[model samples]
Target: MVVQRLQAAALLLGPLIFALSPFFWVDGHYGITGGTLIALSMVPWVYGLIGEYERLRERVPTLAGLWLLLLVIGMFGSIAFGLQGFFEGVFDITERVSLAALDEYPPHSLFLLWLPGPSFPLALLAFGVLLGWTRMAPRWVAVLVCLAAVAFPLARVLRTDWVAYIADLLMVLAFGLLAWRAWHRPVAAATSD
Candidate 1:
């Protein structure tokens, strides 16, 4: 009971914190505060993912495994990306200089930024589809998750505040529904395993 409520809270708060992070940005950079928030947001996101995996694993073990793997990779990459702001802010390094330094280390850049960065949205998109396929969530909720998954990456890559806000709103709506359901209904009763 307590665990479910906590998970629900995490789902509700994670994206909200992420959405608030943009307000902390300074001079086109997230800086320490914003970066901290972004990094912190991942904690709940990870928890939510784990909880979700536990819920779905029995029904689709292989697919759940793949989803968990992708989510972990994506979160790791996101953490590194978020920490860049912290490091830069702490050391007073310019974005160009930081990027250049990363460029000098091709493997680091590839694993930390390029490869895993894109995986997050891809994983989310997969999760959305899986939800509909498995009937774990409503069709509308799954569609919203897919839409948010697509919009999130675009908003981040483009650095568009409005788009980001839209993505965040979508996430809150979709995930919040899931969270609410989780809180109100036990998974065992919600699905037939």
Candidate 2:
């Protein structure tokens, strides 16, 4: 029970940190750092989710590991991009080392504009689909998460900032539903194995 509570807190904290990052970290490097932290926070929740579904684990042992792999890749990619900002801040070399082609873009917007940005959401989509296939939760929960996943990549394709916010909101909704389910799930169900 205590483990579940901690897992729930980790699940909630990932999004909370991400949502508040824009405000708390104005420096672009710090923002990316926040993203890295957000990614780190998600690990325990993922582990808990996998653990909660013991039957699923017995049937498909590799799925949860795959999800963790993707999450780590996405987070590390974020950190890699953030390194540019770190270099800029630490060495004061802020003349746009290699981003000259994006002269018209905002200073740090480029980080979220491509590559790693789309990968994270796509990974989530895959994970959500797998979770749904396992039928460990209501189908609608998976559907909502899938919808949220779509929003992120769509936002990238559209090249608009507001769309990402909508995606974030959708993710929050999906995660909120998961949290509710986790909280209400019977102890016997969790301990059945």
Candidate 3:
């Protein structure tokens, strides 16, 4: 259970941790430390989320699993969009950055920081309403998570960079709640009888 929460936290933290990379970039090399941790943290997130979603499918029987894949896609799209700078080394992201200040940032990848944060939450909204709120997912929790997506992101958007910082904090809370619910649920034996 702790492992599951850590994995969920890793998924959310991967991007937030990246935001803090500036402080650790020593001598032009973020080093194996930052690079490795960032890279390694993703594995468990993918495995854990996919595993949990699959289990949810067994218990619930819906296309929620595929929608989770949609979340993964938007995540990668945001990552790729943000990394428009790194893309410049091999291809041309100049058009992508047009007038952005990061056009000249070295190792030239800082532009990846620009990935859109609100998209995944929005995507989850549709999936949750269609699949979970009606019958499968814990109804109240599903509703709250979706609402948190809108409220937190909207609050941030109205204020600019506030969205990124506050969104990270809120996401930590959301994942923590998932962990709590998953952990505290009655054991299967209690239900099977």
Candidate 4:
């Protein structure tokens, strides 16, 4: 029972955890040093959602299962992109010697713009919509997820990176709320008859 609940929360947590830079935005750590832990964290985030979808599949069927599968893939892809982009920038600096450094590679607004920014929001929003439709997560989380999807792109349209940051903060809040709700919910006993 406890394990089931933990698994459920882990599922909701996968994508959000990935976004919080599951791979540490670690500095001075060099190459795969500090980044390895960050990159490795993606495993749980990916499978977490997969496991959750398995549980959800028994309940929500239909498009919900499909959405969950896509989200799981999308979540992993986002993490990979972030990792690859960061290190690629690192290697570029090393090869160039003087062209630039990691710090200068992925600029302040690189993620702050482009399709890269929407991937997570789209994932979250899709998950939220699916969960909300099933009443698995608090309804407000679904609203926020949809809002994030809309806001991030709109902010970029308006030329405001702060909107992206704000969207990120909201996602963290949604994750916290989902975790808290799941943690507090009464766990059904595996032994209960």
Predicted structure with the largest lDDT when compared to the true one: 1
> Model 4 reaches what TM-score against the true structure?
0.60
In the range 1-193, model 1's lDDT, one tens digit per residue, is 6666777778777777877776777665778988888888888977876777787797899999999999989887777778988899999998899999998999979988889878877988999998888988899888988998898888777776677678778887888887887778665555443
Whole-structure CA lDDT of model 1 = 0.82
The TM-scores of all predictions, comma-separated, are: 0.91, 0.66, 0.52, 0.60
Q: Clash pairs of candidate 4? A: 23-38
- In terms of TM-score, the best-performing candidate is 1
Q: Write the per-residue lDDT of candidate 2 for residues 58-88, one digit (tens) a residue.
A: 6577876666566656655544544544444
- Which has the better TM-score: candidate 3, or candidate 4? 4
Candidate 4 regions off by >4 Å?
A: 5-41, 93-120, 149-161, 189-193
TM-score, predicted candidate 1 vs. hidden true structure: 0.91
Worst 10 residues of 1 by lDDT: 184-193
Per-residue lDDT tens digits for candidate 3, residues 49-168, read 563464566655556666676667545544443343234433433443543655566444342444333445565465446435444447766665566556544633353344544654
Q: Go through the candidates in order and give the C-alpha RMSD of each one to the true structure.
A: 2.8, 6.0, 7.8, 7.3
lDDT of 3: 0.48
lDDT of each: 0.82, 0.58, 0.48, 0.55
Residue 14's lDDT in candidate 1: 78
